[model samples]
Target: MKFVIYKDKLVESVQNVSKAVSSRTTIPILVGIKVVATDEGVIFTGSDSDISIESSVEKHENDQINVEVIQTGKIVLHARFFSEIVKKLPDKQVEIEVTDNFHTIVRSGKAEFNLIGLDAEEFPRLPEIEEGLSFQISNDLLKTIIRQTVFAVSTAESRPILTGVNWVIEKDLLTCIATDSHRLALRKAPISINPNKSFNVVIPGKSLTELNKLLDDNQEPVEVVFMENQIVFKTKNLLLFSRLLEGNYPDTSRLIPDESKTELTLQTKEFLQAIDRASLLAREGKHNIVKLSTLTNNTVEISSTSPEIGKAVEELQLERVEGEDLKISFSAKYMLDALKSLEEQELTISFTGAMRPFILHSINDQSQIQLILPIRTY
Candidate 1:
């Protein structure tokens, strides 16, 4: 393949596609990026069996040429070396050409490098997903949903299905939920476009994390196409495909209590800070646990005790406290994570009891909920 491309566009495309390149793959070709030059534009593809990313640089956009293809061909080059070389090119333009026997030459400014390229045919083909169901969501909203729930996915491999986030769509509503057994996060959003059928799928948490980084915080709509086993996220010039995790995600609906015995409303920032300070002493202990107890005069006492270290206690005024008195202990890390994901100034925390999980919801937005299982401390 021979093409002369603008350095800025080339670098961006390479960097985005490189996210899918596998460094420890048994297949040597999976470590290389396949570059194809056609009449339409130049496409860069990277895959590691689980996820694949393809980024395209059009020949001309808005009457400005981004990539000028001299010949229509294809080649695969080492992803790591090629990305580094393109990023450090001295000039604004780079010329790449592949000759007989897959010999490649990359030139820009006064620097030149000869790389041994592999036949593009060796690269594994991306799964051909039939577009059975599709929908669109604002890029900004999708990123928000991912950030709120992906953190709660289980890191342990004991329950492989719990390592992914569950996505369920019914009618025009989409709900995302993730849990690690100790805590859970849930987010609900309205879909702009309704699919022909409903879907319940588990997507790997790591895939969503990488895809979230690629999305820009904009109002532009991103097209999502879902197949039986694969899902494709398409934006302006980029496409990301991820394989769905196999297995049935456990039913978590029953895990959330329908009613609470106690409810407390407080400033989100104040509560978060109190937990942050209380966790300092808790971190030194065997379990990073913090205790919260309702006090008189509508205040909550946050404290932590460690045998080797001293104790920390702070009283914070609550906006409202009602129902039965409550005292609970939970992982400070889990509480902080759930609190940080909220964008509200005020929050309502509901407790079923000292032994059951507690729920948190934003005062203004009821679409998202966070639940944390209390840690038992005698």
Candidate 2:
């Protein structure tokens, strides 16, 4: 294969696909990136078994020439070397050529390097998911959904299913839920889809995290395709494939209480800041617990205490408080994360009781919900 590609564009494409490159793999060939040159453009692919990424540099884009093909072929070069060499090249453009024996040469300005590549045919084939159950979501919205929920996925591997974000698609509405037993995040958004289309899939949290980095914040739609065991996210110049986690995701709806005994409406930022300050002392505690109590003055006191560290206390005026008086203790870190995920200025936090889980939902946005189980501190 021989092609001349714009250096800046090539660097970007290489880095994007390299996110899927495997650091440890039983198959040695998987360590390299497969580059394919055709009349249309040059394609780059990288995979670590669980996730695969394919990106291309078109020969022509927006009337500008990005790549000029000298010959059409394919080769697999060591990603560690190829990526580094591409970035360090001293010219605005790079020329790559391969021989019949899989020997490759890279040139830029006055620098030229020779690399031995592997046969492209030996690389595993990417999954061909038939476009049956598919939908489109805006790039920014998709990233928002991921950001709001992925953080709550369990880091523990004991319950492998909990390590992923559960996606439930019914008609045009898509719901995403993630929980680690102690906390949960749920987001809902409308998508472009057929009314009869319904799907429930668990996508590995790690995969969504990586995919989020590559997605640009724009109104451009990202096409999502669902298959039996794999899910594909297709953008203009890229295709991302991730294997769905096997097993049924627990029914999380039952965890959210339908009613609340104590409801408090307050400024999201004010509460978030107060908790942030109290967490200084809370961090020194065993479970990083922060205690909250409703005061008779229609205000609330946020405090934390550590036997060896110290204590922190602050009281903030609430917009409104109703139902019952309450005192609850929860992880400071969890509270901060849940509050940060919200974009609203004011939110309502409802407590079923001191022991049951409490939920935080924005007054203006009912589509997002954050629930956290209270920590016991007797």
RMSD of each: 1.2, 1.1
lDDT (Cα, tens digit) per residue for candidate 2, span 1-378:
799999998899889889999879898999999999999999999998899999999999999999999999999999988999999999999999998699999999999999999999999999787968888888999999999999999999999999999999887789999999999999999877754677899999999999999999999999998877999999999999999999999999999999999999999999999999999988887899999999987899999998998889999999999999999999999999999999999999999999999999999999999999998875
Candidate 1 wrong stretches, greater than 4 Å? 192-195
Worst 10 residues of 1 by lDDT: 190-199
TM-score of each: 0.98, 0.98
Query: Tens-digit lDDT track for model 1 on 139-253?
Result: 9999999999999999999899999999999878899999999999999998854445678999999899989999999999899888778889999899999999999999999
**Model 2 segments beyond 4 Å from truth?**
none
Give Cα distance to truth, residue 321, candidate 2, Å. Answer: 0.9
Local distance difference test, per candidate?
0.94, 0.94
Candidate 2, residue 373: how far the Cα is off, in Å: 0.1
TM-score, structure 2 vs. true: 0.98
Query: Against the hidden true structure, what lDDT does model 1 obtain?
Result: 0.94
Enumerate residue pairs that collide in model 2. none
